[model samples]
Target: MALPDPNTSWPPKPWDEAYKVYAESETWRVGDADAIHEFYRGERPAATHRRDGELYEGGVVGWVSSKFWGRPVPPGQNRTRLHVPAPADVASLASASVFSNPPELRFTDKQSKNTIDRLELIGNSDQAHSTFNTMGELKSVFGASVLVSEWDTEIADHVWLSAYGADVALPEFRKGKLVAVTLWTEYRDGNEYYRHLERHAVGAIEHALYLGTADKIGQRIPLQDRDETAYLATLVNENSVILTGIDRLTASYNMNLPTWAWRKKGALANAGRSDFAQLYPLFDALDEAYSSWMRDLKLGAAKAVVPQAFLETLGRGRGASFDIDRELFVGLNTPGNPDGDKIEQVQFEIRTEEHEATTTELWRMIYRTAGLGTRSVDKDTGRQLTATGELLQDDDKEATRGKKILYDKRAIAEQLAVALELDGKLFAGKGGGQFAPPEVRFPDSAQVDPEKQARTIQYLSAAGAISVWQSVKMFNPDWDDTAVGAEVNRILAEKRAAAAMVPDPATFDGGDPTQDPNNPDNQGGNPDGGQ
Candidate 1:
C-alpha cells in the first residue's frame, strides 16, 4: 500500500489545493507556512493525525492561508468546530500543537516531535527528503529540485511532495500552517524509476520578460537571470498589470489565473472539500511567492509559470502515473457511500515486479490498504492502482461484508479484459472482412456463470477474452480461416444447446416402450415386461 509513484511531471499539475493540504497534514508537518495539506474534516477528527482543526459548528469558512482562533460555548451549550477565516472569520480561544500553529519554538514534546520525526524519517528515503543543514541548503535544494523536477518523467502532475526546506511557504506569523507547493511537468523513465520532463525555465523567464517589460512599453527586452524573481516578488502588488502583460506576450486572453482566494477561496474550498474547513493562516501568503527579503535575493519563486493546457491534464500522460496518484488513498481509505462514484474510475497497480506472486501479492496489498490483513477472513486477491495510483474502483470482489466473497461480476470481467489485453487477444477475429478494430483492447463482458463450469470458457470465447489462439493466429498466418470459423460456429451452437436445456425424468425410453411406460404393473406393458 505504499503510494504509487508521483505523477510524471517535475512539479505536480494543477490539483485542488485542498488535496495538497490533506497530503501535508498526512505527513505531520503543522503550522509550516506554504505547506499543502490533506484533510478529512468529519465530526471526530475525520483523520489519523492527533492534532485536529475545530470548525465553526454547522458553518464553514472558505479556503485561505491563515488560521482561526476562537472560544467555545462549553460542553453542552454548543459544539465547537474548526474555525476558518473567510466566511466565518471567528477566533478560537483554545489552541494546541496538533491543530494550531506553534507561536514560538518551545520545549520539544514527544507528541510534537513524533510528527516531525515521522516526516523526517519518511523524507530520508533514497527517493527524496526535505532535511537541510542550513536555510541556504534548504533553499538551494528546494529551488533546484523545483527547477529540475519539472523535467522528471517519473513524477505525477497530480502528486507533489513537501518542501521541508522552504520558508516562503512556511512562515512563523500564521496561526495555522501546512507545507509544499504544487507544480507540473511531464514524465520520463529513470533507469530505475521516473523523473520529470519539461521545457526550459528560461523560456518561461523570457515569456514573463516579454509580457512584463515588453508589452507595457512596446519594446523588446532581454531576460536577466533575476528578472523572473523580480517580477514574481512584485506581481502580487501589480497583479492586473502583470497579468495583462502575460496575456499580451502569450497571445492568449485568459490570464487571471484561478488562484484560490482566502475568504472567497476558503468559501469555495469549504463548499467543495470539507476537510480544509479547519486550521488556517490564510492562503493569501501561500500564493504570494516573494517577500521583500526574498525579492532582493535572486531566488526564483517555487510556483510554476506554465501553459494552461499543461495544468488541465495533470494526472495522465505518457507511461503512467504510479506512486503519486492521489485516488489510491481515497479508494483504500475513505471510499464513502456506494453513490460516491469517486471510486468508479480508480484502477489498481501493485508495487511489486515479481510475476509469480503477482496475483496473490496484489490482493495482499489491496487487503492491507483496506485495513484488512492476513487475520481477516477474506483476503483480497489482486491489488493494483491505476497509472495515477488509486484503488481500482473497489474492483475487489464485491462479496458479502462478513462473508468475504466477490459480489460484482465486473471484477472478474475486468480481470479477463486485462488478461485479454496483455495477451493481445482483443483483436482475435478473422479476415478484416468488415471488422478491423481501431484499438487493440479488451471488452468488458469477460465473465460467465460459475455454475455452468464451462460457462467461463464459452463467455471468454464469445466475448473474446484473451487467449493463446491470438498468438497462434498472428504467428501462423497459413491457418485456415474457413475451418476456424466453422469450428467456432459448431462450438457456439453446442454451447447454446447446453445452455437452453432442461431434463425430464418421465420421458425416458429405458425399457421397451409399452413395457416401461407406466410399468403396467411397474411398466405400461404387463407383468411380462421385466422378463
Candidate 2:
C-alpha cells in the first residue's frame, strides 16, 4: 500500500464503497440536473425505457431516461422539470456559519519571534482564512477533507497548503489521528484516465503516474508520459520518492461531523460523515416536490378544445392556427353538430396550496435533519426569513457551527504546526521557533453588541474590577501582548497630558480680586483664600 502497484485494482477494498459514497455526494454537490439524473438512474436495478409515441427521434427505441429531468413529450409539447440547489445551499450555510469571522490563529512559542513572523507571513500570503472557509464547504459536502502543507521553493518562499476532497484523498489513520494520505489528480485523454498519485508519509512523499481506464488503474507509466505530470519527474527521484526533511506527515484529514465512517472496518475505523449522508432521499424527494409544483402549473395551462372547423387554415402546406387574438373568424358553412360545434375550454386545477404545504414540510424536515433549525424559515408561519434573523434565532444551527469549529481547531493547528516544522527543516534559517501546534480559537457564534461590550469594559475598568491591560484585551481579544501594552501606555500618556494642561488649584484666583495678586481692585491677599 506504500505505492500503487501496476495493473492493480484501484481504490481497493473498503475504498470502493467509500468511493461510491463520495460519488453520490459529489453528484449532489454539483447540483446539476443532468448529472444528478444520470447518477440516480444508474443506481436503479434496471432502467425502464418507454418510447415517446411517434414524436421523439422518429420513435426510435433507446435506453431509459429520467422521469424528472429527461421526461419526454409529444412533438410540440413542453416538458416541465425543476431542480433545487439545496445541497450546495446547505453546505455553504454550514461553511459560512463556521467561518464568517476568521478563527484567531496564534503560535504558543512566544520566544521564537522569527518563527512567529514566518507563520504570520505564511498565513497572510496563503490567505489561510479564506482557504479554510472554502475547505469548510468542501468538507461539509464530502464529510471529510484533507490539508497538505508543502515547502516548494519554486512555487513560493514559504510553505503553502493544498486542499483535497474525500473522493481523491486516501487517508490512513491511527487511533483517529492521520498518519499518512495518498492524494491523486485525474486527467482524461479521450476515454483513458491518467492519474498522478502522490503519497505523503512521515519522512517522504512518493509519486507515481498511472495510465488507467475510467474504472481501473491500468499500469504505472513514466511521469514524463503526460505533459501535466512531467514536472513531478524533475522534483522526485527515479524511485519517485522525495525525502521530506520533517519527521511528520504534511497532510491532515479533517472531518466535518463527529460521526465516524463505521461502514469501513480496520485501522481506518473513524472517518467523518457527510451532512448529506442520510438525507439524499429527502433531497431527492424535495426536488420531486418542487418539480411537481412546476409540473402542475405546466399541466394546468388553459386550453381551448376547438372544433376542427374552428382552426383557421393557413395557405396550403402551412399548419392551421386557433388565433384567439383575432377579432373575427369565418363562419363554418358545414352543418353544426352538438358535440363538435361548441368550443369548450379545458384547464386542470393547480394544487397551489397543497404543493406549497408539501414543500414547506419537506424543507422543515431538511433543516432539522441537516442540524439547521428552521433555517431561513419563520417557524410559526413557515415563511422565508432573513439571514440575520436565522443567526440570531437558530440555536440548532449555532450548536452545529460550534461543534464544527471545535473539530476544525485541532486539525488546523496540527497542520500549521506541520507546516512550521517543514519550513524549519526545508529552509533552515527561515523559521527558528519550536515547531508546535498553536492555540486556535474561532469567533463566538452569537457576537456581543460592540457598543454594549465597550460600555461594559469601560464600567469594569472604572470600578477597578479589571486592569487597563485587561480592559484593552477585552476590547481586542486577538491583540498580542505587545499591542495591548502599547495601547495601555498610550492611554496613560494621554491622561497625563490632559492633567498637565489643567491649571493648578493653588495658582487659581477663583474669580476673586482679593486672591489675585495682579488684581488692582484690592490689596494683595493670601494665595490660599485667606483674605
Candidate 3:
C-alpha cells in the first residue's frame, strides 16, 4: 500500500475520528495517568480533597459537621495534610527488588562468543541501566513502561535505546503481536507549533511527518492559515526520508505484562494500574486522621477562660491587655471583689494514644496493600521497620510474587531478541553479530541468608552430592557460566600444584616405594657400607 499524503490530509479524517474515539475512551485513563504522576511527585488525592471548598460545602465556613461540631473541627486546609510516603516507598522498594543488581543475559549456545559482547553493548550503551531503573519505578507508579529500540547512524554505537512513560507511545496490536506504533512529539518555538509524528507499520517503510506553524523564513502563522505551497514544502523538502530501514518494523514494546487493568472493569481498564493506586484510600485516611489530631492538639493547647467583667473593663481588648506569662490582674470598682480574684483555665486532654494507634493501623494497611508485609512496619510501635528487616520482608513478598518478576524477565528477553534482530539487520557491518534469544537472569529476590547458603553448599560439596563447580556457582550467583568454569579451572590448577609439591613414597626414588624394602636400594645401609 502507498503511504498517505501529508498535503491531502494529515492524520486522515478517519484517523482523526478514531483518535477522538480513542481519546474519549481514554479520558478517565488519562486522568488516572495524571493521578499516578502526581502520586510519584508526592501529591496525594487527599491533598486535593482536603483543600478548602473542594469536596466541602461552604469552604472553611461550613466545615463544622454536626458530628464534629463540639470537637475541635479541623478546617479543610490546603497542603496541611501529610501525603503519606506510601507511593514513594512502594516504588523504591519495588525498583530496588527488581533491579537491586543488574540483570544477566545468557545465551543458549555457549560457543556464541559475540553474544555477551552484543548484549553488553546494548545494555551499557545509551544509559540503558539508568533507563531500565527508571522503567522499574514507572512500572510501580503507572503499572507500565515502554522500551524503544532503534538504529541511529548519528549515535556512537548506532543502537539507540530509550524508555518512555505510558503517555506518549501507543501500540496497536493485531492478535497478540504488535503491528504498528504511533509516537507523538510536540514542542514550541516562540509562538510556533512544532509537532512531529513517527508511525511504524509492519512490513512497511517507517513514515515521519513534521508540521510547524512557521513559514520558511520563521514567520509564525496559524496551521490552517498556512498557504498550500508552504505546507507542501514543509511536507516534502523540509525533512529527511528513509526508504529502507530495519525489517523488524515495530521499534517499541510495552515493558509491562497485561495482567490487570487500571481499575477493575471500567473505562480505565486499558490504562496501567499502579500498586500505589490500591493504597490511595489508605493514604488519604491517614492524612485526614493525622490532620484532625493536630488540629485538636492546637485547639486544646490554646484553650483559656476569661472573666466577662474583665472583658468589659478592658473594652473588648482584654486579650491584648494581659500577658499570659505574667500574673493577670483584674480590678473592680468595689474595694474588694472575690469574684475577680481568680480565673479558671479550661482543661481538655487529647486522646493521643488512640490517635497513635489509628495512625499506626493506617500505616500498616498502606504497607500491606503495597505488597509490603505488615512486618514491614515495627510490629510493636508501628514505626518503619529496620532497613534489613524491610529488605527481608520485601524479599519474602517478592518470592511469593515471583511470577511478576518472571514476567519481567521474559519481557526483557523478548525485547532483547527484537533489539538483536534489528541490530543484525541494520548494523551487522559494524561488527554486531547475530545472536539467538538470550536467557535473562534477575537477581535472586529470596536471598535470606547468604552465609547459611554458602555453608550448605560447602557441606553438599564435601558430601559429593554436588560438583565443585556447582558449589562455586551457589556461592557466587552473579558469576556467569564462563566465569564459573574459569573458577573451577583455577581451583583444579591449585590442587595440581599442591600435589606436585609433596612426593609420594613410590615416586621418591623414581620407582614404587611399596616394593620390597629389602632390595639393594632399600638395604642400602649394608650394601653401601660394604662397598
Each model's Cα RMSD: 29.3, 10.0, 12.7
Q: Which residue pairs does candidate 3 place in steric collision?
A: 506-513
Clashes of each: 94, 0, 1
Candidate 1 wrong stretches, greater than 4 Å: 1-23, 26-492, 496-531
Candidate 2: residue 16 Cα off by (Å)? 0.5
Global fold similarity of model 2 (TM-score): 0.76
By TM-score, the better pick of 1 and 2 is 2
| Tens-digit lDDT string for candidate 2 (1-531) | 576677778776667777898898888888888898677557644433434545333222233233344333447765555689889888887787787677777866564677877778655444887778788888988888888886668877788766778888888877767778899999999989899999999988998889988778889999999998888899997688998767777888888886555645764455688888778878877888898889888879998887777788897999898888866555565556546566798999999999988888887787778876774555566575665665555567778877877778877888888888777776778784346688887776534447657877977978989998999888897799999999999999999999999989998766855555566554554445356
Candidates' C-alpha lDDT: 0.26, 0.76, 0.56
1-531: candidate 1 lDDT, tens digit per residue: 111122322112222343354343332234332232223222123333322444443333222112222222234553223221221111111101011211111112233343333223322333222211121122221211111111111433111123222212211112221111222221222322221111111112112222111101122222232333343444323321222111111110010112234336432221112112232323222212222223323233232332222223435564332243333233223345444323223223422333324334433343333222322222243443442232232233211111211111111122222222222221233111111111211212122223333444555657777453443333333478765565557766887898668555577545565445444466443455555
Per-candidate TM-score against the hidden true structure: 0.20, 0.76, 0.59
Instruction: Assess the local accuracy of residue 301 in candidate 1 as a C-alpha lDDT between 0 and 100.
Output: 29
**Over the stretch 413-488, how does candidate 3's per-residue lDDT look in tens digits?**
6667667656666766443444455777776653345655766787797898999888888788769999999999
The alpha-carbon lDDT assigned to residue 200 of candidate 2 equals 91
The true-structure Cα RMSD of candidate 1 reads 29.3
